[model samples]
Target: MTKKKSARQLRGQLMLQIAAGRFFRPGFPLNETEHRYTVYSNAWFIGDPPIALPVGEVVASTEMGHISSAMIAIVDRLEQQRPDGTDDFVIATGGTDLVDDLAYLMSFALNRTVSRNHDQTRRLVTGDGAPRGRSANDLFPELFEPRQTVQPGQWDDLRGFMKDLLSLSRDDFARVMRVIRNSVDATRRAPDDPTGAYTDLVAALESVSDDKLSTSVTWDRYDGSKRTIIDAALIDAGQEVADRVRAAVLEAERSGLKRRFISSTLARLSPDYYRDDAAGSIRPPRAPDLERMLGIAYDIRSRRSHVLEDLGEGVWLFTDGAETAYEPSFERVLTLAGLWRLIRHVVRRYVINAEKVAPEPWDYREALPGIVEMQLAPQYWIWQVGGLTAETATRRLNGFAEALIGWIAGQHSDGLPLDQVCQEIEGLVPTLPDGEARTSLIATHVLWHAWVDPTDHRPEASTFIDEYKAVLDAPSTSAFTVSLLSNHPMPTWSADDWVAMAQSRNDTRHTKSQAPLPAVVDALIQLFTADELELAGRHDEAVAFAANAVTELPGNEALVGWEARLVAGDHDPDFDVRTFLFGERKREVSEEPSGHEQSGEPSTEQNEAVTVEP
Candidate 1:
């Protein structure tokens, strides 16, 4: 058979179970059978340990009281440290007796020296017997009057025999008044009733005297009377007392005294009572409520106001109850506000930088193709130039071109060399025009340049070319020139080449027929040939002259096509030759019959068709 556990072991197990249940089974009902049984068992174990208490038991009780006193003393010390300096000493010291009693009870229940100061205080005041070592008389001296036997006759010895309990601190005084107030409230008397429960409170207050010990009682009586009497004098007196305390606080603040201490003391005396201005004398302005006060301070700091100059120092100086030797200056305030604005500006710039508002150079180039398609259209250009003159429109076109060039040159995979681009564009600005039209023109020109020049490695080059073609197809004089300029194979062309081509075209005296078509073609070819083909090297006359040869052989489709292909290499330059021919020769050919018919005869379609020798 297994051996039964010893009593001590069983008790230890029970204690452990109780602790575990309390900790882990949080939602378990205390009223449940298991919980009740556990609590009862724990209590029994506490009261009756394995060993009984010694016969004397003096050591246990004495030790309990000592521990209790130590706790009370510590609490009393903390209470005394309050800066308000109001007398809470009675409440603080009275706690000692309570603590001692609690300790004794705990020692009795646990059969061990376990001190419970909190419980001791409750027992001393409310317990049945006249408290053990000390009576209520000794602990609360302000609560009772001196006992005296009245002699026979002699006005019944009324003066000295009267009890006075008014010397109590505000807390104790309020506690007594609250008791009366509660009694009145419980009665639920109507305000119109003069001889009601509230009047009874007044009668109770009147029983007290006018000495230091009776001041609180007198004030309480006065206040209680006002409720029923409706006398203006009583109302004014109550208001006067409130005003005095507020005045004290304000004076302390103005004089740079310990305002916090004064204010705290006042608060402790009567938390709701504060001064208000009376008629006749100029009462100081009532201080703002805490939130309003703080908000005003913030506004002053925000605006950096110097309005506190007359009072000395700054507005914040008054809050700390200290005066600055030097007064605030208007200039200083303005400077501070300016500094704040500057700080905000810097912070915004930094945040914007972190967010990367400007993209990398590679990103711009990558997006260029899409941007050109969306923004550079004939209608869009016209819309941009709306009311501008041709001269203005041309200037804008040039500026836009320069801007694109700058953007291309500055672009890199890492980041756009924005600073360099800006500098270059700034240099080009003087050579360009002003206004929105100028901007649009310059942009169109730069886009055209990117489309025609294969050396321009901008990722958007193809998109630019496509958009340029779309714009050229739209019927407009400007669109024709833009398309021609963009599709022209003249990436290497210099300013002189353009001037020479114009001069050569003027010299040809080409009407809208015969030499007209060839002259136009020749000028384009010559311009392409004159471009700076090789970096820092002499011009290649062979390539240049070869390009010109294509334009010279008019009506020879094969030769012209070959020469054009050679000049542009594998890249197909986007140009509309039909549109150019139509624009220049449309009027000249409108009256003539189409080549589909023979001249002076209605010839058959087969005879009208002539094959040109290749």
Candidate 2:
């Protein structure tokens, strides 16, 4: 039909086509700068119909031989982009040519449909579509219902978590992901090689789990002469190398392999499980039971290795049982499901806490503004006021708060009036330290109500304002401290006063000698000024100020909302300013252990394999 068309033309030749997968949910688009391909989940590509040749979620433009590996790498990366264990970002890959083949390979690896390029014009001449021949396991679909779809708001969180995971060293990141993939594969392999699967799963843990063995050698028992002799011998033998021998000896002498494994696993577990009760969550197994279970698991792995033990045909059922319950079997072994769950936990904990990923994204001040500020605020004050690190600030704060709470509880139990307790707390304010006194006063007020009477929580607004005025007048007083001190009561500061205070704080913040004031302090200053203006009946000025404040502090939703309301002239008498940094509690506070006391270990009596929600 075209002067005898060439064989290459009749049968479409393989081209270096750029393969891409469209994620069902939003993600922060990554550039091809560092990565081999780009992720186009950002605004430019989002919601656009996939009509173009190179739609975003780009894996790579490679020769046919290397395409599968590129797809696998991309899928692996995308898997980590998930926000949490619950939700999955559906990355559906598709294209006309070898893109379909690449997507099929990805689907086979992930065991899910990643492609929808049904009308493929190209074909693999030999019909070996996947790079590696597809396995029987890939043909069967596992029972999977996505718990929830990731929301658009969570895409930034996904980006943050992914960035952290991806930032790991090549070996470390690979090892972590390898362990994770093996753990998942181990579960799937239960039907045919249950014992082998169990062995692999246990081995997976051993590979990643820290032995937590102490390498420090205690020379306290040795005499001075012997110590000197040993040191000389070490120096002669090469000091650093000799120290490794001593450390190894000490580590082996102190703890066995099993103890090390148990210790590491327990250390990784959520501390919440160690509480007296599970606090309405699933109760984790007691330490001894978990130890026993892990011991059995190790023994089983050993049995499989030494004697070639088989876990029988019903192993899959055992692997599918509820993770929070013990196996009702002859040996009372922990269910494979429970063990698998623990493996996942251990793997996740290892990857997330990897040391090289410096200053974890989740721990960043901006990510969890209020809680992180609370964590770092003590350090800030310690440096600002006392020229100390966080030696005893936390303990001191907790001790002070505990004493005040107990005193208030005791006073209330002794039938003292609530107002009298407030007065008593106000008296104690004078004896407290300058930087911490106001915080202590506010704590005293809040905790008194929480511990004593939730119904009548607030003191008379005037009494509260009067009692706090002296503290507020201090030059060290910050907007954060002020906000915590008052909820609904308008600060006595006028608009001009607020502006001057902000300027003073800003100046201090920029001063080299001074500890930097947190941005929240300035943001709150603008917010409080807006409130003052609104109170002054200058609606237009209030709107303008709030709009400017939002620009200054862009991420705070409360500021944006307040600005919008002001613009719309919608005034509600009950409206109170709420930001992620500080918000008035809308629910009754529950009695819980103080942070100082939360380190209590779990009791050994309650022994059952349970999921730790935390």
Candidate 3:
């Protein structure tokens, strides 16, 4: 005797057949001989012989133009695999078209099974046998019909199902409603939820009436009570049940038993019931919906506690008979982390928009408050909770600084006012703690931008130089400070003016009680005028002047280069002497031989010439 097929096996077979035929079949007509076999096999499976015969003729006579070859191949393969002595004849005699209809019918049957044993049935339907064709509607018209066609019996059945779904102990009712509504709302709000499907299901359900439900079935017993009595009863029952279940599960867990009742119950309800399925089971439990009811009880308790604490009140009894208040113990760290994530999202949005339209120097400044308000303060809590360590915090801070610098640079490049940008930078600098590497880096970046701007000749540049000098002089050493000083820009001072200022500072330092070293002043002159020793030609007097300049202002590269060139008689042929003396070119040079001998020898008069002094 053939062993009985499990529901799962039946579902799998039906799905396979439907997918194979509908998805694989070619529209082209089969050859006459092949058509007969196709019709016969299909009719036999569907328990219809005559229909299969005609369909077979149709398949043979008609041109197989639109049908897929893969579908025909699959059908052919299945037909060849029929077991010997089995009732294959039914399938063989069934018409090909009729088989398609039969597959749809099987799908409806599967759906019905799911509706009954929702846990098991849902699993099967979701996994394998689902409806394929329009004919499934014919088998279960009550489910697919428009709003007007639902018979009174079908309405009653639906109402009963709803009541079963909602029925719970009085205490559990509120919790059940809260959970369902919240879950539904959450799903509705989810970015990825299938809105169209949800809307269709809701619309369909709403069209059915619950008028047939008896008034006595409700918690208040239709007594016009402010609160429903049924709700309170259901909640109380749910709490009792949940407490027992929790005790049992905890005990099972403590014993390390793999075969727990909860697990078995969940598994039995599987295929339809997900571990995350907050909806509970479709087949209502024998006891009041305890889990759901208890949840409502917990919510009520929480609300009551909050009110009492806020009011600084004495003990207040709940006349509704809710036994205990609910308290949630979600981890504090987790909550903080969640809050931080939300804050970051908001801050990022604000920063991006602010960066786009902020005018002048205020742009970066304007974005800073939003950043602090939305991201930084909130992130501090996360850090305090050890969600992020000090090193990670430093890295994140550095990244933010770099992004701000980059944004400022981009604005400056686009013709934003340089002084305004510098002022904004100065304003935000205090927010970052002093002496940090990030602070120095940001300062350096700001100074670099100001130095590069040809038009930014404000006295503020000198003030910035003074600030950097102070930072460098501090006992705390910084590589960034060293680099900044080394690259300091020369102001638009004349050669004579720079020389006189250097001598005065030097003399005052020795004679006037050791005045400030004027480090920035010295660095500026040196970087702008440094000399290269490789130049050809030499003179003692000019070399002596260069030494004096270097002594007057140590490491004065610009002055040294000018003096060295004069002493060596290595003047640039392209240099216009008139422009050097009068600040404008007086004449242009026509083609002429360079004043050096062709044999790579210095001109004979080079050593005898007097060096020109500024």
Candidate 4:
């Protein structure tokens, strides 16, 4: 019923054709020219031509040692061709010639050998074989070291080079170290999960920026905008929809930040973002603009990508592409590197703006001695701190030098010379009256808390009143040195300044109506603080104060000349600093202790709300 198909219908004709010698070319031994060329090529490339053999048989019969030697010989021939002494290997890959096949094998073997050595080195350095729990930096620190500031002289031609990383002060340098640490951690966990690190890296960025823009998502606006998945996909895929994509990027950026804050300011910078000028330059990115860019980068990393729908609620929900672990392709790694560099620039600016420490880099160790020697008469007792070298600064004096340096710099930015300023402050001393009140103000009020060594425990230690009554019944009458013991030590005090000082101290606890102290009382306190120097029979010290204080008072120069003449002849006896600086009032205050209790341990709020009496 059915015709039987010949199973070998084409086979007989093929056999007959093959037998006829026309179907296949009769083998001709290499003719004269071909034979010589083949012999010359074999001689030149492989040394003496061996008896022809099947490739499998040649490899099988020859020991690996000789085969490897042949491979090395092939490599040497390649290396000899270049004049610069560099090796080059050009393989005719399209052909199935024995030389090409051997070239492929030789290259593979060399690469495999290199990879094996690298694996061994990594195992020795990191003590692990797998990517789990091991960071990319740990395995290849040379390639993956996270950088914040640009290296010095790295890109001199670029404008960003002027604002490079090394320019950061010590404080700002410390802030960006956190970013580097977190980035390393992210890369370490990338094998299994990049999201934890993704989340952390985002948080680190926000932490540095002061996170004032996180709630800027416009639910109604994001839902209403017709930014299709296809548009976001084009950007994610690195397609060049320049104007359309840039507008979308900028719209999202502006929606997150204040409109007034964004403009050509960032654009005029390094031109990493949109370039407004025909000549490309980086625009300065606002905080919100940077944040939105980071978010989009995270999306490209598959975190809340626009491929997911927001459902008009402003929240992107997972549908298909989202996952905890991500494929860390080279493209994603490149995107992240770019994002990190921009983040460094933005965060450095934020730290500088918020910190109020003086921008001037003054060392307190140098400033303190300069102030004492050139400026004030040496009655003020600034504490003796140890040297400011790295080894001793922490162990000896603690952080005192650092604390005081910052405080002094913040107090004044005036252009006046230090010596001139001290002279002016001394000028105000003679204007106040000379009496016991001045002594009390210096010994008990002003100098007590500000000057005395914290380690002292004498009556002067526990209390800071000096008894001038022992030297002279009423103490020598002269306007006291105002500069040494007062906060405004190195500046002139006007009549208005004296009143303002009293008012400032008074304002601390009292209402404005009750803030100003009695001017007469303040003048009286000034009188005896300087009088104590004269009372100790130290006529030289007394004369110095009087001359420094008064310039216009009639007969003041004559009085000072007479006092100096008298003091020149007077050889003062050994002085008792304790009895001279501390008075009977100190003992009385300690003995009385009625209004306030004295305890070794201070209460948490001890004397915190004391009445302001001036």
Task: Name the best candidate (by lDDT).
Answer: 2
| Candidate models: Cα lDDT each | 0.28, 0.43, 0.28, 0.29
Off by over 4 Å in 2: 1-160, 213-255, 272-288, 312-320, 324-330, 357-614
lDDT of 4 by residue, 1-614 (tens): 22422312221111111111112122421111111101000001222233221121011112222011122111100111223334322211111122322222222111111111233323323425444324333222222322212222321222232123223443343344445445534533432343444445455554454323323333333422444553556665554565566566556655542321222123223443333311221123344445344444444434433354111111111111111112223111212323333444444344334333322321111111111223221111112222122222111111222222222333211111112211222333234354333332232222223332335424432332233212222222111222222232333334334333333333432453322222222222232222345555555545544443232223543334434544575432233222222322223222211111222322222111222110
lDDT of 2 by residue, 1-614 (tens): 11533322222111111112222133534222112232111011121222122222333222332111122122211222334444333332222333433332223223222333211111111112432222212111121111112233333433444345455643454465456556655644543455677789888887775645312225553235556776777876876788786676556534766656656776676654445323322324555567567766777788888999765434334223433344434244554545655665565466567765332222011111111111322211211122212233223333333233332233211221234435545555555565544454444344334344335445563466456655644333333343432342445666667656555655554566433333444555566666777878877767765665676678777767777887788753334533234334332224421222323433222111222210
Clash total of candidate 1: 18
| lDDT of residue 223 for candidate 1 | 27
Residue 387 error for model 4, in Å?
23
lDDT of 1: 0.28
User: Which ranges of candidate 3 are over 4 A from the true structure?
Assistant: 1-283, 288-413, 416-418, 425-433, 437-445, 448-455, 469-614
Q: By TM-score, highest first, what's the ranking?
A: 2, 4, 3, 1
All candidates: TM-score? 0.15, 0.31, 0.21, 0.23
User: Which candidate leads in TM-score?
Assistant: 2
What range of 10 consecutive residues in model 3 has the weakest lDDT sum? Answer: 361-370
Q: Give me candidate 2's TM-score against the actual structure.
A: 0.31
> Tell me, what's the RMSD of every candidate?
36.6, 27.0, 30.1, 30.9
